[model samples]
Structure formats: C-alpha cells, structure tokens
Target: MDGRRNGRKASRRVGPPTNRRRRTGAAAPKDALVEAVRQSRAATTGSRVVELMARRALVVAARQLLRQHTDRCTKCGSTFVTHEPAFVHCHYCGRMHRVANASLLEQELFEIRMGLRLAS
Candidate 1:
C-alpha cells in the first residue's frame, strides 16, 4: 500500500530497548503459581469420590458391628429381628420381643469365646 508499510520497514526496531535480556522457558513465577494451584485442585477433586466412599463404608460397617445382638420373640422364639429399631417381631406367633445390650466386658469375652474378629 505504501513504502513505510512494507515488511522490511515494519521489522525495524525503534531502539535497543530498555532490557537487552531474553526470557527463558522456565521463567515467570506467576505462571508457576497458577500451574501449582491448578494441579492441586485437580489431584484433590479426582480422589474426592474415593475418599467419600471409604468414609461411608466405614460408618456403615461401624453401625452393623455395634448391633451385636438380636432377641428371640417370647412366643415364637424366632431371632428374626426386623423393622427400624430392631423390635424382634415373631413371624410365627406375631409377638414382639424385648432386647438388651450386654456389658462391654461380656461382649468382648463373648467375641473372644466365639472367635469373632474383624472380617477384613
């Protein structure tokens, strides 16, 4: 379009410029911080699902383990405990049975006597 707008004239620098140094590939602290934050978030988000599942499974297993006993209905003598709070209802005779938790020592002794240990 014009003599000044030519590629040769456009490539000319005004001066030597303030800094005569060139930035290396490993330069810039701000970029490094940004990359570190991105990587940390990615690592945590990826393993979050595994952490939640493990915590849920632990709580469920603890609940099951705490329910150490089931009563037998007086009328039918069936140990088939059911319902929300585990009110042992006899299917045969239609009766509700009362249950109680044994002492901590007794439970431990019983577990030892029965060779009961963690399944895992």
Candidate 2:
C-alpha cells in the first residue's frame, strides 16, 4: 500500500536493465588472430633471410675455388674451358658448379697466378 513498497516491487519485477550502448572496449578476437599471423610471417621472413645468406656464402666459396683454377674442377680436378659456363662439368666427379662472386674470384685468381709466378 505504501509508495516505497510499490517502487521496490516494480524494480524487482523488471530486474536489472542492461546498458545497450556502452562500448565493450576490448580488442576483437580477429585482431589477436591477425597479430599472431603477423608474428609468424616475420619469423618466416627472418628464417628465409638466413637461408639466403647461407646460400650466398656457399656460392661465393664455390666461385673463389673456381677462380683459383680456371680450367680445372675445384672438387675433382677435371679440366674444362672458362667460356662454357653451363657446359662445364667435372667428367670424373660429375658435379655441377656455378660462380656467383666474380670480383672476389678474379682477385683470388690473380693472387694464385702471382704466387705461381713467384714460385717459378
């Protein structure tokens, strides 16, 4: 019968009302998923860079050896011409080789040539 009693009954009947317009202020799950993808891509790219560097180093070493002996295989001592780059093959060993760092190979070739001249 009292006003306070009626207000309490009305509040209890309706229960608590939820706010429909309040921002959740939390990052979406998709955003976290995207961040994870980005991190994975970065890791993959870093590993690829390392792999490329190793390949380059191997190529440089091979080139240096090739330059040291123009007509001979570095691995098996088979003879060939410098002009035929692709056709060059170690007949005895049958290994394929390629030159990558031409400048370094040339320098090494010069050093070896000079050393042989001095030795003679």
Candidate 3:
C-alpha cells in the first residue's frame, strides 16, 4: 500500500498537472513596438522624457559599437576596419564595405544639409 501510494505521488509530480484547466488567462503576445512606445511615453512632459531619450541614445550607441566590432572580413577572419563614418574597409582582401547606420547617417546628412543651406 505504501509503495503504491509513493509511486502514484511520484508519477503525479513527474508529469504535467492532470488539471490543465487550472491555468487561467491567455498569455500576452510579445510586441516590441508596443513596448518601445510604452517606454517612450511612460514619463510625463519633462525630465522623464529626457531620461528616456538618453536611454534610447545609449541603446543606439551600443548597437553602433556592436556593428563596428562584429563586422568580419569575407576573405579573412579579421574584423573590418572603419575607413570613414559610413564605410568600412576589409584589411585582408582590400574590399570596401558600406553599411548604412540609418539614424546616425541621417543625422549627419541632415547636419550637412543645414550647413549647406546656411552657406547658400
């Protein structure tokens, strides 16, 4: 009787719960856009907005760092070298690589446009 009771308990614990209906409520879908918007707007109209902006800026900087470090040479196993703000040159095969860091490049381009506008 004791062995049978122990075996029953062990089996019950080992497998999924027999009562599947006990889990309530459907899980929410993972939405990156919704989360980003929520985080962006969570703070009221002042320092909170600035802090959120700073956080976003840091995230962008980290992403740029990853891009710079992880870019690999196609011909050899070396990381590509940054030749210009928007270009990298592979040292092994002397291949020029161009990558668009959309936001950063856009900002630089905008600055140049503004300067040209002022000059004109």
Quick one: best lDDT, which candidate? 2
* Clashing residue pairs in candidate 3 (N, C-alpha, C atoms within 3 angstroms): none
**TM-score for all models, in order of appearance:** 0.20, 0.29, 0.24
lDDT of each: 0.55, 0.57, 0.55
CA lDDT, candidate 1, residue 86: 29
lDDT of 1 by residue, 1-120 (tens): 554674655655677667666676776699898888778966758755343568878886555332433555545567665532323446767764433443555644555665764433
Please list the Cα RMSD from the true structure of every candidate, rounded to 1 decimal place: 22.2, 24.4, 13.3
Question: Which residue segments of model 2 deviate by more than 4 Å?
Answer: 1-33, 38-65, 80-83, 101-120
> Which segments of candidate 1 are over 4 A away from where they belong?
1-68, 79-83, 101-120
Candidate 3 versus the native: TM-score? 0.24
* Total residue pair clashes for candidate 1: 0
For model 2, residues 1-120, the per-residue Cα lDDT tens digits are 554664674344366787767677976799898888778966658654433558878876766444433577767776743423223446677765554434644544655665833433
lDDT of 2 at 55: 81
Instruction: Quote the positional error of residue 3 for candidate 2 in Å.
Output: 82
